[model samples]
Target: MSIKLDQVVKVFGTQRVLDDVSLTIAEGEFFVVLGPSGCGKSTLLRLISGLEPLDGGRILINGREVAASGLHLAPEQRGVGVVFQSYALWPHMTVAGNVAFPLETAGRSRSEVTRRTEECLATVELTRFADRKPADLSGGQRQRVALARCLAQGASTILMDEPLANLDPHLRGAMEEELSAFHKASAATTLFITHDQREAMALADRIAILWDGRLLQADAPEVIYRRPRNRHVAGFIGQGSIVTVRVTAAEAGTAHVRLGKAGQDVACVADTQPGTAALLLRPEDIEACGDEGAQLCGRVERSVYRGGFHEADVAVEGLDAPLMVRLAGRPAAGERIGLRLRSGWLLPA
Candidate 1:
């Protein structure tokens, strides 16, 4: 089923939790709602599942109005199942029992329930643990049980709210891959929410970034990362060193930017506005220069080894902000060196 939010808004007391949000999630697509804490990402999910009422606007599924001015659908009627961060499984119920609960609630026959329960367990690769209670299972096992329960419910649309937050790094990565594969196999329309950029980039077919209860941008992961619409989106999507510079002059395909105290014009992509501009240059894009190189120069302030690469802190003149450049080889402190900025993005300072 396709999910669509049309000017959706949610309010509590006087606080607006979701602000004029509108999105369209295609059927069978894996969509991710990404944002920081208190950004209303969960609230948006609840609105879709009909667990919360919208203050205004409408919600449609497959072109039919599901939420509007005063009307709302119940959670079960929406054909949506949600897996929460806490795993929310019952300790008293066996794995098969928990998986069967949803079907039982819908009044399915005993034989049919048993068949579906087994199918769900097989989907999660937990068929052997079906008789075990939640208390006897590890965290990852319990999480799989939760996923199996949702599958047993026969929900065609899924809403996962920070589902992998409880797992360790290694397990989290494994679960992400599992979830991606499951989504492909089930062909369910999924809306997965998370604060982790890696998770968002990895699991999402398209990502919608939210901040302060507002929808900032929605696009494919690479597009959002490579060409952020504003300064905030650019800074939020990935790790980078930001610098303030002046757009001294701009021509056809490049801009001559002046880094204060650093001296001279550095050629960069002509995407900056006049006057003060903010340049976002990823550390990996910066290179150390030898005797014959670009005019950009810096004094290596410090360097730290980060397992794979060395992170160098360089101080360039004219610019008050420090630049963080990533180098393969470590350059010692106080070392005067020439630097070449390979690629960067520009925004209004």
Candidate 2:
């Protein structure tokens, strides 16, 4: 089932949390809501699930108005399954029982519930742990039990709220793969919320960013990474640096924005009107070069070892802030170097 929000608004006391937000999630699409704390990510999920009433605006699921005109459907009546951030599994019940509870609650036949439970457990590769209680299973296994319940319910629309926030790094990676596989196999329209940028990029077919109580941008992962719409978003989304400049030349959808007269310039993927703008340059966009052949030269202020690369902060002449460069091997402090900037994103300044 597809989900649509039109001019959605929510208020808490006097502050508006979700301000005129509207978005569409196509059926079977994996859409992720990306945001920081207090950005209303959780509130948006609740509003869609009918757990919280909206102060204004309308919501439609599968072409039916679910929340509007003083009418709202209960959470269960919305035909959507929610996987909470916490694994809401029963401690006394076994995995199979937890997975089958929803089916039983919906008054399905015994044979159908048993068959669906087995299938759902197998999909998460937890068939062997079906008899184990929540306390006896690992964190990942408990998460799978919660997911299996969602699957057994046969809800076409699913909402996940930071479901992997409690797992370790290794387990989180494993769960990400499982979630992706499940999405493809089930073809359920999913709306996932998270503050982790890496997770959003890994799981989303499209990502919608929320900040300061508004929907900032919604696009493909790579598009949002390569061409952010503003300085705030470019600075927030990735490990990058933002440099203020004036766009001097533009061609073929690329803008050559320069810092100042006799200062360095970098080409960015942008098509805005030429004026003051901010350029976003990721670590991969920069390369080390000889001082004479470079557009930006600087003295190494510091170098931090980051396993695969050294994050070097360079203090360049004429630039107000130090430029951050991720380079192979560590460079000693006080060493002079030049940087070759391959590309960046230009956001209107």
Candidate 3:
């Protein structure tokens, strides 16, 4: 199913939860909406699932209008299934019973429900655990059960509101793989909501960054990470530092910028002009090098061991913010180091 939200709006008393948000999710696409808590991520999912009525704008499913101009369809009529963070399964029901509940409630024949339940269980690889109850399953297994129930509902579009938020770190990693495989087998148009950037980056075909009730940026995972549209997205999506730089010249998607006292050429948008602008420097953009070939020099203010690497913050003379660098070994505080700028993105004015 394809989802299109045109100027979608929601409000609670004096607060506007979602302000003029608009985006189209392609059919069978795994689209993720990423934002911090209380940023209307859950409200967006609720509106799409028909749990909440829209205060403004329109929602379309497969080119059919579902919510608009006071015309709100019920959840059952929308043909979309929602899996929430709590994994709201009935403790008394077995896995097969839970998967078959929706079909049976819809007045389907017993044989039909039985066959469909079996098929859904097989798809999630939970056929062996058919008789197990929700309380008897592991966190990951319970999540899969929730997914199997969604599939059993015959929903073309699946809405997941941080379904993996309750899992342990190791289980969350394993469940990500399971969810990917489940999406492939089911071929559902998935609209996932999460505050976890790692989860969003791992599973999404495209990611939309929502902040303060506004849609800040939406693009492929890597594009949003490398070339964020603004300061908010640059800081929210990944670890990096935004520093003011003077763009001396720009041509062919490259910006020759002066970072403090050192000059370097970095990646920029086509329309970037020569002027003062903000530049985003990720850890990978700065490199430790020999003093002879160094483009810049700084003293390490702090370093933290990150398993295989040491992330050091280097303080240069003229720059206000410390430049983050990844080193193979930890360097002592106040130690002078030679650095080179390999690449960076110039934020648009």
Candidate 4:
């Protein structure tokens, strides 16, 4: 089912937690809502699940309004399964019992419930541990049990709220792959909430970025990463440098922007009128050079080797902040180096 939100707003007393956010999730797509803590990501999920009431606007499922004008469908009638940050498996029930409990409650026959439980166990590769209790299972296995239970309950859509946050690094990676495989196999519309950019980039077909309780931008992963709409979007999505500069000239294909206090002209590719702008230079786009080559003069303050590459903290003149440049080789302190700024995005200052 395609989920749609139209000018959705949630208020707590006088505080507006979600501010007129609207978005749509395509059927069978891995849709991710990404933002930091207290950004209303979880609140949005709760509203979708019917766990909370919407203060304003409408929510539609399959083109039918589910929440509008203070009317909402109950959580049980939503046909949506929610996986919490902590796996919500019953401690007293065995793995199979946990999976079977939901089906049994839905008025299914004993044989049907048993069959479905076994199927779910096999899907999550937890068939052998069907007789084990929740405390006996590993953290990852317990999570799979929660997913299996959701499946057994016949959920057509799933809402996962930072589902992998509690696992170790290795287990988290494994679960990511497993979740991707499951989504492909099940073909269920998924809404995954996370603050980690790598997780969102790795899993989402399209990402909806939220900040300050508003929907900032919703686009494909690569487009949002490459062409951020504003400084907030660029800074929130990934690592980059936003340097303020003045527009010396403007044209269709290119513009000349002055950088630093001395006003060094840097060529910029722009599609609109150029004025005061901020240039987003990624670390990978900057190359280190000697006194020769097209170089911006800077003095290296410190250097650190990060596995495959070296990062140098260089103090550039006329700029308010120091420039972080990734180099092919390590350049030590007191070393004079030059930076070659290659490709970057220019935003209005």
Q: Pick the candidate with the highest TM-score.
A: 3
Candidate 2 clashing pairs, residues 3+ apart or interchain? none
Q: What is the C-alpha lDDT of each candidate?
A: 0.84, 0.87, 0.93, 0.85
lDDT of 4 by residue, 237-343 (tens): 87767777677777764666666643444445556465777877778767787667745788888888988888877888876656778877878798888777766
Q: Whole-model lDDT, candidate 1?
A: 0.84
Query: Per-residue lDDT for 221 in model 2?
Result: 96
**Once superposed on the true structure, which residue ranges of model 2 sit more than 4 Å away at CA?**
260-271
lDDT of 3 by residue, 1-349 (tens): 8999999999999899999999999999999999999999999999999999999999999999999987999999999999988889999999999999999999999999999999999999999999999999999999889899998999999999999988999888889999999999999999999999999999999999999899999899999999999999999988977888889999999989988788999999989998899999999988899799999899999999999999999998878789999999889999999999889998878
Off by over 4 Å in 3: none
What's the best-to-worst order under TM-score? 3, 2, 4, 1
Give the alpha carbon lDDT tens digit for every residue of 29-60 in model 2.
99999999899999999999999999889999
Model 1, range 1-349, lDDT digits (tens) per residue? 9999989999999999999999899999999999999999999999999899899999987777879998898888788889999989988999999999999999999999999999988888899998999999987888888888888888988889899998889898888888987887778899998999999999999999999899988999998887677777888998777788777776664666777544344444555556777777777667877747756778888889988888888888876666787778888899887787776666533
**Model 2: worst 10 consecutive residues (lDDT sum):** 260-269
* Clash totals for all candidate models: 6, 0, 0, 1
Question: Per-residue error at 121 for model 3, in Å?
Answer: 0.2
How many collisions between residues are there in candidate 3?
0
Best-fitting candidate, scored by lDDT: 3
Among residues 3 or more apart in sequence or in different chains, the pairs in candidate 4 whose N, CA or C atoms overlap within 3 Å are 261-318
Candidate 4 similarity to native, TM-score: 0.93
